[model samples]
Target: MTVLGIETTTDVCGVALNRNGVQLDSIVKNEKHIHAAQLVPMIENLLSRNQLKVFELDGIAVSIGPGSFTGLRIGLSVAKGLAYSSHLPLAAVSTLQSLAYPVWKTIPATESIILSVTEIQRDEFAYALFRAIDFIENHVPDFHLITKNEKETVEKIFENPLHHFLLCGFQAEKFYSMFCSENRNVSFAGKEFNACSATSIASLGERYLERNVIADVSSLEPVYGKNFIAKKSNLFSRITQ
Candidate 1:
């Protein structure tokens, strides 16, 4: 089976092609907020270089959300459009889950936690904790939107000190100091393995396809972790006071 995977959850915009769950070719560009314009052409280039057509793709997989709000929309819109137009199935992978899969595949089935932390705002992060049980199944008990409050995070880390923790994702390095300061049991995944990979998305997508866990292209929505809270105006207060 042939599949295309798209990832646009962070600074990176990546597209990958997989055949039988192995990566064929991938294009990853870490440009600043350029996913809106760069994704389609990158996918096109990957297919053209491989001498393949969009119709030849069996399915499309996309990182649905919990990263950049705009990035998620751009990726899902493209995936939905492709799936709808080509009459192919769609797999919606969570941005955090896609990222954690790679790490989960590498680690042994020991008692441990895999933290996928992506930058949401300056000094703020969106993190998901995956409890790795085995190569095939890791459970994500919770994911949260948190700030740079070291105290609360440190407490959470120590809640289960016996379980080894592995950290990975965008801007994961920023948490190194905080996590490492008190708990040596937790470690960061190297820079090479941190960023989310479309390859992982493809692999996960292939599994989703096998189990008939496809998405409804007509009504699929990006999983924005939280609602966008617009900054309220102080003009009314000033006028009244």
Candidate 2:
């Protein structure tokens, strides 16, 4: 399966071309907040260099949010456009899952737990817990948008002393320090595993495509993980508009 994967759920803007689970080419730019402008060109450049066309791709897979609102929107806009135009299936991979994927690929298969968390704002994060038994990731119920102040509650979740668990993703270091202070049986995934990779997105997407887990392009939306609140204007402010 030939797939084009996009990872822009964070500050990174990444694109990858994967054929049958093998990554052919990828581009990543971590220049803070330029994903909106860089994503499309990155995709075009990668496809052009590989001598591939958008229409030739079997599917488009995107890391559908829990990160920057604008970044996710830009990536999804492009992916949905390409999928709609090419008549290709669209696959949605969770941002946390993409972050957890590299760790899973490198970890030894054992009955362990993986906690994936990506920074959302101030002290808050987008987090999910996965129980990896025999190399399969079983997601624990209810994704969370947690803050540092909620450490006590988070601590209770990782208080399990029997299972070997790893905390990973954007703020792994921060979580590592927090968990270690409590003497929890938790380890960090390391600096190299910080950013989400489009290549990983492609691989996961390929599996989704094979399983016919395609998304409805017209209705697909990034998982914001929270309700968006629009600011309301007072009478005077509305009158000015």
Candidate 3:
């Protein structure tokens, strides 16, 4: 199966092609505030270079985020559009899952825990916990927003001494220092694993596709970690008046 993955959940704007579980090609640019302008073009370029077409892809995958709000919208919009136009399946991969995927692939499933986190604001973060026993199960399935002082919540999650913890994603080091400093089994993932990847999104998407876990293009929404209240502006009203 061939899948096109779009990732714009943070500063990175990336597009990747995964064919039969192998990454065919990818384009990733870590530039802030450029996702709106460059995402579709990057997808086009990636497909063109890979000698593939939108209709040829078996499915489309996107990072549905608990990250940058604007970036998530742009990525999901593009992915939904492409899927709708091409009549392809859509997979909504979690941004946190994408951040932990690379590390999960290398680690043994011996009571290992992957803690994926991203900063939401000063001293606040959104986190997802995955336990790799038989397979990676999202032990903490939902993204929970918490502050640095919420040591009780974090400690409860990491109470298993037998579980080796792998901390990853944006501000992972900060979180580690804040909570896991004294834990002998806890460690930080490399800098490369700190960012979300389109490749990982694509790879996970393929698995979702195989399992028939496709997303509803019409209603699928990014997980913003909290209620997204849009600031009302009267610019349109003023212009109309």
Error of 2 at 12 (Å): 0.5
CA lDDT, every model vs. true structure? 0.77, 0.77, 0.81
Question: Considering summed lDDT, which 10 consecutive residues are worst modelled in model 2?
Answer: 232-241
- Alpha carbon lDDT of residue 228, candidate 3? 81
> Residue 174 lDDT in model 3?
86
lDDT of 2 by residue, 34-151 (tens): 9766777787788889888787889999998788777777788788878876789999888888788888888766777778888877677888877665333231134788777777
In candidate 3, which residue ranges exceed 4 Å CA deviation?
134-140, 229-241
TM-score of each: 0.87, 0.89, 0.90
Q: 2 or 3, which is superior by lDDT?
A: 3
Candidate 2: clashing pairs of residues: none
* TM-score ranking, best first: 3, 2, 1
In candidate 1, the residue pairs with backbone N, CA or C atoms under 3 Å apart (3 or more residues apart, or in different chains) clash, namely none
Off by over 4 Å in 1: 134-141, 229-241
Per-prediction count of colliding residue pairs? 0, 0, 0
The lDDT leader among the candidates is 3
Q: Report the C-alpha displacement of residue 182, candidate 1, in angstroms.
A: 1.5
lDDT tens digits by residue: candidate 3, 76-190:
8788878877789999898888888888898887778788898866778988878776333351257788897787888887677777789999888888888778777778987
- lDDT (C-alpha) at residue 115 in model 2: 81
